[model samples]
Target: MSNVTSNSPSASNAVKPLDQGEEAVVRALHRVIHALPRAMDAELLREQGLPLVEYLTLMNLSETPGRRLRMNELAATCGMSLSGMTRVVQKLEAQGFVQRIRCEQDGRGWNAVLTDSGLARLEQAWPTNLAATRKYFLDHLAGLDLEKLAAAMRKIAT
Candidate 1:
């Protein structure tokens, strides 16, 4: 047995190179991580006239209470830096999909609120997103235990 556990910090820094089987797993994961997003983004842009990041930003706002969240919180939810998220939100605002408003609870902060137009666009775009998600991600996982897969991904992410 390898002196390594999948969950072990020591395994990550171990002196030995990964054996062939282990190397193959890592290689496959690397390929999927990079390929899936690009493929999905392309599909989204082709079918929905919406980039993935924009779609995700709208979706995140739509789900929040009052259809709003603090700007920094929205940035975190979208896995973006504040400045990067600011740029995306500004574009959305320009398109009339969202608006930035001073936070009512705290005048110092800002919130990004989904506009009615954004909700309508999200409604129109949902089917395309669902189909792409299934085609690019779910369909490939046939017969695998999804909950287990999610747990494994969570472990790796952390």
Candidate 2:
């Protein structure tokens, strides 16, 4: 259970009124956080015939050793719940993009192995993903200190 129970003391304490500046920043961040993913997902769907999560799953696997990762770790890497990631992986497996194999050292766990088809899919998605990222994020931030903004984002994310 989370300590963030509604109407509890912790919840009350966790809530705080935002100052004018903070509220503006928070609202802007909130809008972008919600909107950007949708925009990117739409682009991926139209251009690559893939969903955002699928692209992310393939990309994550591609970057790892042997193009594979433990299922749990893959879930966390893609910021998905275990069951949610499992369903996505299953879809990929059905599509021949990946396969599930028994963990070499841990028989109790499974690993998601990226296939050549998955790499091809990721490659197909890359241009659209890059364009969407630039259109929604990087391009908008032009002529500012990106490092400072990145540091602020890191601070807030943590």
Candidate 3:
């Protein structure tokens, strides 16, 4: 097997230098796409009393049948690790947003179910979430650009 090193001369030589305009575009895209979510998340989440990840988890649970999902499945859907999910769910449970129940079929597994309060929170938060999403994201991109961006994201995700 060939070993790769960050300081290797061959690796350095293989990298093509980005031009000024390309660099500017890359930097601007990174800043706008990455920073906008954080800013919007902070503002919207603070007002709604939940973080973006928590809101997304609640929304995901709400969409499921009986507002319940297996812990492993929820982790996959949320793009989080099992341990990370456990922590989030624990916090939600503590706050009366969700409940952890033993899986019916599997004794070792657990399910996360959205509580009524969770549903109520989701209903109250949806408007601000939708408006912020539209204002910061959808409204800025053209139709063609949006399609292209979605396609690119799908490719990267897979």
Per-residue lDDT of model 1, residues 22-136, tens digit only: 8888888889989988888898899988999999999999999999999999999989999999999999999999999998897999999999999999999989899999999
Q: How big is the positional error of residue 123 in model 1, measured in Å on the Cα after superposition?
A: 1.2
Candidate 2 least-lDDT 10 residues = 1-10
Query: Cα deviation of 107 in candidate 3 (Å)?
Result: 1.1
Give the TM-score (vs. native) of candidate 3: 0.77
- Stretches of candidate 1 exceeding 4 Å from the true structure: 1-17
The collision pairs in model 1 are none
Which candidate has the highest TM-score of all?
A: 2
Superior by lDDT: candidate 2 or candidate 3:
2
| Alpha-carbon runs more than 4 Å astray in model 2 | 1-17
Compared with the true structure, what per-residue lDDT tens digits does model 2 show for residues 28-123? 888988999999999999988999999999999999989999999999999999999999999999999999999989699999999999899889
Candidate 3 lDDT by residue in tens digits, 1-158: 12344776777776666777878877887799788878668867778877887888899999999999999999999889999999999999999999999999968999999999989988988887888888887787755577778998899779
